[model samples]
Target: MKLVVRVKLLPTPLQAAALEATLHACNEAATWAASVAFENETRRPLELRKHTYAEIRERWGLGAQAAQHAIKKTCDAYTTLKANLRNGRYGRPSSRRHARASGKPVVFRPQAAQPYDDRMLSWQHQAHTVSIWTTAGRLKGVAFTGQAEQLEVLAAHRKGESDLLFRDGKWFLIATCEIPEGDLNTHPDGFLGVDLGIVNIAATSDGERHSGRRINRKREQDRKLRSKLQKKNTKSAKRRAKKHAGKEARRNKDINHKISRRIVAEAERTGRGIALETLTGIRERARLRKPQRTTLHSWPFAQLGSFIAYKAKKAGVPVVYVDPAYTSQECSQCHHTARGNRPSQAVFACRVCGFVDHADHNASHNIRQRGWMVWVCGAQSTAPELNLIA
Candidate 1:
């Protein structure tokens, strides 16, 4: 349950230069340290952090502790990435050749607002709350990552929280606060089921279907502007190019959050489980059709699933990811197997039983049934010798 809140780091022009400089120095230090570790032991020997920090400090003319933190940060990254690979949670670690991105590298945490890790980073919070990082015993600057107020704000808002600290160059303020959650078990009558779709974003088991059209006018306008910027020679193009990558991510995340909230609120009345497609090969299969590639990725199936999962958990409602097999093709009435049952985009009429229904509605029913089977019957379908979704 961790969310990054980005804020505007309102550093004065001079302060911005210094901050950026320090960050570059840190990144360079990390790169050098990584190089040293790899060269010293090509066999993946355990890293030794003892005096590397001291050595780096002497070479970079920074404080000794910064050097140590830098090397430690580099090692921690390599190790964590390695661990993630082992756990099947991430891809292979990056080679030095492919490394990119900005921001100062840290061992475990950033150095700015570093003292918060130490239980003391001076901060001011009267009205708009300021998170001040300390340097030479004076508070330095605040973080502006995104809705993320300075980490220090959390300390003031959440009393009895630990003071802030910076591990590498990152500031962190811990908050021990309790936000009210309305009683989740308040009602047990109303129930709603949802089915994620390809053309339509969602088709509820209850006849409500939501389309996945990008309807935010401002976002659409921004995208068009970005498209225009990407063509001609201008700084705005580069800036827009950079910002454009983030737009899709942010847009999809926000939309998923809203959609998940609506679905959760609908189901919370019954304390029931939400039904969702497992979404295994939706992308691959959908992409087999040229027009569907954009649609498939635009659906943000993973984010939608994740949003539903967390929201359902926080509420007393649970979510069920059914097998998603034949959800669209299987006849809801006679359990008939006929691809022709789904005659068109909006229609599903069973051939074997002569039953008729909207395609999305029939799919929704199958999803709900499969979810119930999984949740209540503890039924898991056997894996085939060769599994293919198409």
Candidate 2:
């Protein structure tokens, strides 16, 4: 599996200045290359380089490798933009959004991340330092720090290009690591069902509730603050908003990591496979009130599912995706399906057999049973009455 390990780079003032200058020169050269490509209708890196390479080297004072990377980066950006246009990401071709997006040449941010090949960057794992190429010159002994596990992975399995990015006045290097997966667990004892929801982010069949209350509260607070800042629209307010831009996302990602780690650990310990809902197109299918829309949209259910999957795979734990249709409305005990089974958001009461349980808990039980049926019988087993048969 391919994983990205990010480490913070701690550089001296001189090193930082050199890094900043390198990024600015590279991006400026890329911008000029993009303009040339746009005018000449050139999308291939080689063809675009034919037009801009010599000038980039002479004007930007970049080394041969850096010049090639900048040109390639510009071409990559255009390719991505073309793909987005084809996918209708900017809406229909007749729409103003599409027209505006398609009519302009792509521009690069001054401090946008630049990829570094092995020739351009060298790691000193034991010393926790790096020697990297910069526009001013080659920088040596630049320090970096990360978690112990990340450092271990970086030393043992890191490969491919590393991206140097400047964000919120901090420098970071994201290194790719190719970690080997463990042997697959062909025989699993059971399935650990995980039900995802807005209130409780994840509820497992083992009756563990990873609540999202705190997360939701914090998101709400951030939203309110953001609204106030936008209304004020002052320089200081904009600065504060920019500072808080990714705070919620970072916090959510951390929580998801912890939750996924625990879930995978428990399933591996008990020799159980992980079961998740196939929630594709959930955003379009879901309908909510005005205020609740933000909550639903902001929920990171997919992120949590992905985290569980990758961690499970690394540990040789099997994973299955089951149809989520009617899982919340169906009774886990009696297999009865009705709207009345779920009288409220949190409670599940079976009308047929008078069995009661937590709504999310019952849903997870249904998911677990469905996952088992799908695994053993080779059927979807999503219908409420499918489990009633011998």
Candidate 3:
């Protein structure tokens, strides 16, 4: 598993200026290289190497590796643009043409974070300092501070390339570390089913529910705050609003992390895999009414699912996705399929079998059953067996 640990850097005034200058020069070179590469139709690094690598190095006064990394980054941007164009991802020519145009690329804060290899960056644990290469030459013993877990990762498994980023008036070194995968555990008791919904963020087949009412209330408050801020139309008001946005986002993400951790721990303790609904294109397919569209779009289902997946993987817990079609409408008790089975958002009652339960709870049970059929019964069936009804 690969994880990034961000450490705060405390550089001297001179070192900070040097770092900023180096980033400015590097990004300027990158923008120039990107324009040239786009014009000459050069997409490959090797192709750029043969044509313009040395020229850029000499012209920009950058070190050899720094120049090469910048050009490679530009090539990557162009590759993505071309791929998107080919796939018809962009609707407007203004967007497409702007992406492909040989215009000067925006250099926000001088693109100040340069990629660091082993040659360019080193860390000292005892002294709590890092040595990094800069345009002004070698910068050694730059002090840094981080949490214990972040420090531990740097001490142990820090590998590959790290990036030096300057943001919010502080310098940070983002280190990428590789951790070994865990052993897989057998789930003899079958899977723990999880149903994701708007009202309750997640409900397990075992009747555990994580309610989203608090999140919904917070979002509504944020929406009202944003509306008031937008009316001000002043620079400071906009800045304050942006700051609030970041705080809210971090809070939501932290909640998701905690929830995912608990869910994964439960699965691991019980020796069970997790079963989830495959919700690809759910927004477009659901055809939600106007009043519900905003809430639905802002639900963050994908983010929550991703958090669960990565945490599960780290703990060696298996996760499976079942087709979501009719999962809510189908009866978990007697396999009865009818739209009327789910008469309300919060309730599910089967007309045929007289079964009643919480809507999300019932859906989770159906999801677990489908997962069992796929994994154990050697059937690729998504639909519930209707034989019981007849």
Best candidate (score: TM-score): 2
Answer with 1 or 3, whichever has the higher lDDT: 3
lDDT of 2: 0.88
Residue-pair clashes per candidate, as listed? 26, 0, 0
Better of 1 and 3 by TM-score: 3
Task: Residues 1-390, candidate 1: write the lDDT tens digits.
Answer: 222222334555655555445545665677777666655642132344652666666666545445555566577666765565565454333543223311122233233321122233333444433543222223355543323343443433343323233332333344333223334442334335577766567788778777765543445566577678877758877865765666666776777778877888778765666777777777655424665564566557777777676566556665667777777889877888678887787899988889898888888888877777676655322211211000
Better of 1 and 2 by TM-score: 2
| lDDT, candidate 2, 1-390, per-residue tens | 777888999999999999999999999999999999999999899999899999999999999999999999999999999999899889999999999998988899999999999999999999999999998889999999988988998899888889999999999999888778877777889899999888898899999999988888889999999999999999999999998998888888888889988999999999988888887877776666788789989877677777887787788888888888899999988899998998998999999999999999999999999888778865322211110000
**Model 1 lDDT vs. the true structure?**
0.57
Candidate 2 displacement at residue 197 in angstroms = 0.8
- Candidate 2: RMSD to truth: 5.9
- Candidate ranking (lDDT, best to worst): 2, 3, 1
Q: Identify the candidate with maximal lDDT.
A: 2
Whole-model lDDT per candidate: 0.57, 0.88, 0.78
Cα deviation of 206, candidate 3, in Å: 1.7
Residues forming the 10-long window of minimal summed lDDT in candidate 2: 381-390
lDDT of 1 at 131: 41
TM-scores of the candidates in the order shown: 0.70, 0.91, 0.88
